[model samples]
Structure formats: C-alpha cells, structure tokens
Target: MFAVAAAAGQTVRNAAQRQLTQTLGTVGATHVRFLFGFPFAVVFLALVVAWTGTPPPRPPAGFWPWVASGALTQIVATALMLAAMGERSFLVVIAYTKTEPVQVALFGLVVLGDAVTLPMAAAILVATAGVVLMSLRPGQTASRPGETAGGGARPMLLGLGSAALFALSAVGYRGAIISLPTDFVTAASTTLCVALAIQSVLLSGWLALRDPPVLIAVLRAWRPSLLAGFMGALASQLWFLAFALTAAANVRTVALVEVLFAQGVSRFAFGQRSTARELLGIALIVAGVVLLLWVH
Candidate 1:
C-alpha cells in the first residue's frame, strides 16, 4: 500500500520537476525538491510527533552517516534524472531508473543485511526487463540490432548512474530507519525530516555560492516549486514508510507502477501515442508486480 501510494505521488512529482527543468534548468530544478520540500518534511515530523506524543529519538552514532549518505546521493540522483529527461522522452528516462530495484536489492543485502529471497530476485529481473523494453524506440539503435538505443551514450550513462545513486540512497535511508529503534511512523518521519534538512542546506549553499541566479529563479517560481515540493515530500514520506516495512528491493520493484503511471501521463498529458512494444512493456510491469505481491 505504501509503495503503491508513493509511486502515484512520485509520478506527479517527477512530472512537475521535469517540466520545471525547462524553465529553471537542471541544477535549479533539482534544488526545488529539497529546498521546498524541507519545510513540508518538518511539518510532517511535527504532525507525527504531536499525534503520537513522542519526541524524536536521539540518533545513535551510526544514524547520521546513513541518513546523510542517503540525502547527498538523492540530491545527485534527482539532478541526473532531470538531465536524462533532456536526452530522451520522460517515460523512457523513468523506465531506465526502474533498474534501481536490482541495485537496491544488492545494496540492502550488503549494507543492511536485508535478505533477498529467490522469488523477490526474480521479480526484480522481470520488472527490470520490462523497463528495459519500455525504454526503446523503434528504429533507434546503438551499432546493432536488438540493442537499447539512447539519445547517446552519455544519456544512457546518466540514466544508469542515476539508478545507482538512487539505489544507494534507498539503502542508506533504510539503514538509518533500522538504526533508529523506533516505530515505523516516527522513524520514517523523523528520518525524512533530517534527510531533507541535510539536502536542503547543502543544495541551497551550492546554489547560493555558485549559481545565485538559478537560486533566485527557484524562489521566483515559488508557486510551482511549492507544488513540486509538497508532492515530493508526500511521496517521500510514503517511500520512507515503505522502506521501514520491508526491504528496499521490494518497495522499488513494486514501485514499477510508476512506469505505467508515466505511460498514462505521456499518453494523456503529453498526447504521445504508445507503440505496441511499449504497451507490452507496461503489461510485463503489471505482471511482475502481481507476481511479487502474490509470492509475498
């Protein structure tokens, strides 16, 4: 449930951020998610604490390292994603990142000792293959037949690098949550607030020092930025909760629904027509999600 809801909200958030990339550019748009979302994260934390009547827990020696790693990597990941969208269609860029589930599984196992059962591993591969297909455009090839084509090698690299960074971030956040020794709601909410705080400050500092105009533009576009920020914060809150409940692998694999969501968006919002291959890719994604849910 958490993964599903996160996927839905995230699809909207990604759309907003990607569109803002046109006006704000990559760096400026990337800052929107963190800088604006931080306030919402704080509110979420406040609400969580008030409802539960529990103060935020004291972080252990290891907590900051984990959360900070997540925060920093996520900042880079969002930048890479927006840059990749510049290379290809938004849906294809999104599909490329679906590969994160496999990396997340490996990272979670090694970093946090989260076991990946065979069924879950199969689901990851199946869903990832579907995404690989979703990324293709007919008659576009890279030196050979049956190969995935990109705008260039650079865009492919950007998408893949984004996937790796996102995977690492997911593992880091989960590691932080596990180290907390608190209930899922409090742990997830508190961790989100801190992670956003770190990302917000760091990104704001970079913009202020190196790209003041972009920073100012981000502020000027406050209305749209605020929507992006709220949707991003809501999606992340749900993602953190999902991370607390199970392996990051499970959450991301199921989050493949975002691909289907993107398909709908591309069709309706952008008036893009889908090819047969892309439709099949969407089906495989659904089937993979169903299989994962069934086995688990």
Candidate 2:
C-alpha cells in the first residue's frame, strides 16, 4: 500500500518537477524537491516522534555514510532525469528510468547484501526488457541499429545514468533505514529528515554560489514548487517505509507501475498516444510485476 501511494505521488511530483524544469533548469528544479520538501519532512518526523513519544535515534558511525550517499546520489539522479526530460519524450524518458529495478537488484546485493531469488531476478530482467522495448521508436532499429530512436546516444546515456544513480540511491536509503535500531516509522522518518536536510543545504548552497537567479525563480514559482515538494516528500516517506519492510529490489520492481502512470499522464494530459510496441512493453511489465508479486 505504501509502495502504491509512493508510486502515485511520484508520478505527480515528476510532472510538477518537469514543468518547473522548463523555467528553472535541471539543477534548480532538482533543488525544489529537496529545499521545498525539507519542511514537510520535518513535520513528518515531528508527527512520528509525537505519536511514538520517542526522539529520533542517534545515528551510529556507519549511518552517516549511507544516508549521505543516498542524499547526494539522489540529487544527481534527479538532475540527470530532469535533464533527460529536456531531450526526449516524457514517456521514453520514464521508460529508460524503469531500468532502475534491475540496477537496484544488483546494488542491493552488493551494498546491503540483499538476496535475490531466481524468480525475482527473472522478473527484473523481464521488466527491464519491457522498458527497453518501450524506449525504442518505430523503425528505429531498421534505420539506425546503433543509435536511439528520436535522439542519439546522449539522451539514452543520460537516462541510463539517471537510472543507475537512482538505483544506488535506493540501496543507500534502505541501508540507512535498516541500520537504525528503532521502530520502522521512527527510523524511516528520521532518515528522511536528515537526508532532506543534507540535500537542501547542499543544493541551496550550490545555487547561491553558482546560479542565484534560478534560486529566485524557484521562489517566484513557489506555489507549484511547493506542491511538487510536498508530493516528493510524501513519496519519499512512503518509499522509506516500504524499504524498511522489504528489499529495495522488490520495492523498486513494484514501483515500475509508475511508468504506467506516466504513460497515462502522457496520453490524457499531453495527448501523446502509445504505439503498439509501447503497449506490448506495458503488457510485459504488467506480467513481470504480477509474477514478482506471486513469487513473493
């Protein structure tokens, strides 16, 4: 349930951030998620603390590294994703990012020592292939086998890089959350608060020093940016809760449903229709998701 909510919220957040990107650029738009979201994160943490009647746990020596990695990598990943949006169709960009589940499986194994069963691995592969198929354009392979359909290698590379970084971020956040010796809600909320603080500070400082006007623009567009921030924070909180309960691979694999949500948005909101290949890809993704749930 948390995963479902997170996926839905993330779909909305992505749309809001994408719109902001046109005016603020990638870095500024990325900053909006962290900077504007920090207050909401704080409120969430406070609510958890108030309800539980316990303070946030003090991090051990190892916690900072994991949380820091999560924070930093997520910022970069979001920037890369927003940058990719500028170069490709929204659906194509999202399809490329759906590769995160496969990458997350590998990263989770290496970083958090999470085990992947054969069925889970197969599901990841199937879903990844589906996303790759969706990324291709009609007659793309026949005309230019080496290059991507609409754009060249750059957009593809950007999307793949974003996927990889997001995978790492997920593993890192899960590692951080599980390391805490507290209840899941408290631990997840605390980790979220700290991660958002780190991201907000780092991005805010960078923007202040490098691109002041973008910061101003973010302030000017505060209404939509605030909504985007709230949605982003809500999604992150739910994601952390899901991570606390399950493997990052499982969480991310299920989160592929976000692609379907993105497709819906593309079609109805943007009047972009899915091709036959894309529809086939969506079917494969659904099959993979169903198999994954059944196996689990």
Candidate 3:
C-alpha cells in the first residue's frame, strides 16, 4: 500500500518536474525538489513527532554518512532523470528508469544483506527486459544537437546511470533507517527530513555560488515548484515508510507501476504516444510485478 501510494505521488511529481525542467533547466529543477520540499519534510517530521511522541533523531556516529549517501546520490539521479524527461517521448524515458529494480536487488544484497532468492531474480529479469525493450526504440536518432555519434544510445546511458544511482540511494536510505534505534514511523520521518535538509543545504549553497541567476529563477518560480515539492515530499514519505517495512528490492520492483502511470500521462498530458512495443513492455512489467507479489 505504501509503495502504491508513493508510485502515484511520484508520477505526479515527475510530471510537474518535467514541466519545470523546460523553464528552470536541469539544475534549477533538481534544486526545486530539495529546496522547496525541505519545508514540507519538516512539517511531516513535526507531525510524526507529535503523533508518536518521539524525540528528534539523535544519531550516533554512523547515521550521517548513510543518510548523506542517500541524499547526494538522489540529487544526481534526479538531474539525470530530468535530462531524460527532456527527450521527445517521456514514456520511453520512464521505461528506462524502471530498470532500477534489478539494480536495487543487487545493492540491497551487498549493502543491507537482503537476500534474493532465485524466483525473485527471475521476476526482476522479466520486468527489466520489458523496460529494456521499450527503451530500445526502433530507428531512434539523436533528438538534440549536442548528442554524440551514438546519439540513439544517450537515453539508455542516462536512464541506466540514473537507475544504478537511484538503486544505491535506496539501499543507503534503507540502511540508515534500519540502523536507527527508533520505531519505523520516527525513523522513516526523521530520515526523510534530514536527508532533504542535507540535500537542500548542499544544493542551495552550490547554486548560490555558481549559478545565482538560476537560483533566483528557482525562487521566482515558486508556485509550480511548491506543487512539485509537496508531491515529492509526499512521495518520499510514503517510500520511506515502505522502506521501513521491507527490502528496497521489493519496494522498487512494485514501484515499476510508475511506468503504467507514466503511460497515461504521456498520452493525455504530454501529448506523447507510446509505440505498440512500449505497450508490450508495460504488460511485461505488470506480469513481473504480479509474479513478484505472488512469490513473496
């Protein structure tokens, strides 16, 4: 349930960010999620504390590095995501990032000692194959001027790189939450808030120093950024809750439903059409998700 809610919220957030990317550019758009979302994260944390009667998080020596790992990697992954959204068809772009489940399983096994059974691995592969097929559009060419000679490959590179980094971030976040000596509610809320705070500070400082104008632009574009930020925080909170409950691999594999959500928005909102192959890809992803749940 947490993963489903997060997927829905994230689909909305991604659409909002895709719009922001055109106006703010990639860096500014990425910063908007952290900067504007931090306040909401704080609010969520306050609510959690009030409801749960838990004190603010007091970490020992290790929590900072773990949370920081999640925070920093998320920023980079988001930038790559926005870059991919700039492509001609966002449906395919989204399909590419849906590859994260396989990578997340690997990261979780290594970092969090989460074991993957043979059946789980098979489910991951089935789902991953669907996205890979969608990402490999026939006769795809460089849609932008700055693309390399292997222009067709740029989206795949961006998407796969983004997937791998997002997988690592998932592992890092889950590890941070698990290491905390607190209930799942407090741990998830506190981690979400602190990670956003770290991300906001670092990104804000860098933009102020190197891209003041873009920072100003981001500030000026507050209305849309607010919407995006709220959805981003909502999604992160739900995702953290899910992470607090299960392995990152399970959370991410189910989150593949975002591709189906993306399909609806792509056709209706973005005026982008998915090829027949892409629809086949979405079907395969759904099959894999069902198999995973059944196996679990």
Candidate 4:
C-alpha cells in the first residue's frame, strides 16, 4: 500500500517537476523537490517523534556517508530524469526509469549486501525486459526529428543513466535507513529528514553559486514548485517507510508500477494512446510485479 501510494505521488510530482523544468531548467527544478520538500520532511519527522515519544536517533560514525550518498545521487538522478523528460514523452521517460529495479538489485547486493532470491531475480529480469521493450518500441523515435537518425540515442542514454543513478540512490537510502537503531517509522522519518536536509543544502548552494536566476525563477514559481515539493516529500516518506520493511530491490521492483501510472497520465492527460507493443509491455511489467509480490 505504501509503495502504491508512493508511486502515485511520485507520478504527480514528476509531472510537476517536468513543468518546472521548462522555466527553471533541470537543476533548479530538481532543487525545488529538495528545497521545498524540506519543510514537509521536518514536519514528518516531528510527527514521528511526537507519536513515538522518542527522540530522533543520533547517527553513527558511518551514517553520514550513506545518507550523503543517497542525497547526492538522488539529486543527480532527478536532474538526469528531468533532462530526459525535456526530450521525451512522460510515459517514455518513466518507462526508461522503470529499469531501476534491476540496477537497484545489483546495487543493493554490492552496497548493502541485500540478497535477491531466484524468484525475485527472475521477476526483476522480466520487468526490466518490459521496460526496455516499452522504451524501444518502434514508434518511439518519431518525436526526435531535428538531429540525425541517431537523435533518439541521447534521451535514451540519459534515461538509462537516470535509472542507474536512481537505483544507487535507492540503495543508499535503504542502507541509511537500516543502519539507524530505531523503530521503522522513526528510522525512516529520521533518515528522510537528514537526507532531504543534505540535498536541500547541496542543491541550493550550487544554484546560488552557479545560477542565481534559476533559483529566483523557482521561487517565483513557488505555487507549483511547492506542490511538487509536497508530493515529492510525501512520496519519499512513504518510500522510506517501505524500504524500512523490505529490501531495496523489493521496494524498487514494485515501483515498476510507476510506469503504468505514467501511462495513465499520458493517455488521459495528454491524449496519447498506447500501441499494442506498449500494452504488452505494461502487461509484462504487471506480471513481474505480481510474481515479485507472491515470492515476497
């Protein structure tokens, strides 16, 4: 349930961020998620602490590196994703990001020592294949006409890079959350607050130093940016909660449903119709998600 809500919230947040990218550019738009989301994250942490009657856990010596990795990689991933969104349809961009589950499984193994069962591994492969099929569907190239025949390659590469970075970010966040010696709710909330704080400072400082105008633009567009931030923080909170309960691979593999949410946004909101191949890809993704859940 948390994963489903997170996916839906994330889909809306992505749409909001994508719109901001047009005016603020990718970095500024990415910053909006962290900067504006920080307040909400603080509120969430306070609520968790209040409810639990426990103070936030102090980080161990190793905690900073894990949370910092999560924060930095997430900022990079959001920037890459927004850049890709500028070049591709929302559904296509998100479909490409759906490839993160496989990468998440790999990263989780290496970074957190989280092991994937054989069935989960098979499900990840199936879902990954669906994402690739959706991304490479025959008519996908029609949108890019200005450059040479290889014009489509740039967005594809950006999407894949975004997927890899997002996967790493997920692993890092999960690692940070689990490292905390607290209840799941408190741990997830505290980790979220710290990570968002780090991201907010890092991105805001960079924007201040390098591109003041874009930061001003983000502030000028505060209404939508705030909405995006709220949704982004809400989604992250739920995602962290889910991560506390399961392996990063499980959380991310189930997140493949975000692609389906993106499809709905494309069809109803943008009047785009799915091709037969895209429909098949969606089915495969659904099947993989169901298998993963059953095995879990």
Quote each prediction's TM-score. Answer: 0.91, 0.89, 0.88, 0.89
Name the top TM-score candidate: 1
lDDT of each: 0.87, 0.87, 0.86, 0.85
lDDT of 2 by residue, 45-152 (tens): 999999999899999988999999999999889888878777644556666787899999999998888999999999888877777787665543312445455656
TM-score of 2: 0.89
Which pairs of residues collide in model 4? none
**Candidate 1, poorest ten consecutive residues by summed lDDT:** 141-150
Clashing residue pairs in candidate 2 (N, C-alpha, C atoms within 3 angstroms) = none
lDDT of 2: 0.87
Which runs in model 1 stand beyond 4 Å of their true positions?
A: 80-95, 141-154
Candidate 2: list runs displaced more than 4 Å: 81-95, 140-155
- Write one digit per residue (lDDT tens) for candidate 3, span 1-296: 79989999998898789889999987899788888998999999999999989987697668888899998888889778767666554645566677899899999998889999998888888878876776565665555787543244676678778888999999999988988899998999999999999998999899999989999999999998999999999999999999999999989888877778878887898799888898898888888888888897
What value does the lDDT take at residue 210 in candidate 2? 88
Better of 1 and 3 by lDDT: 1
Q: Weakest 10 consecutive residues, lDDT, candidate 2?
A: 139-148
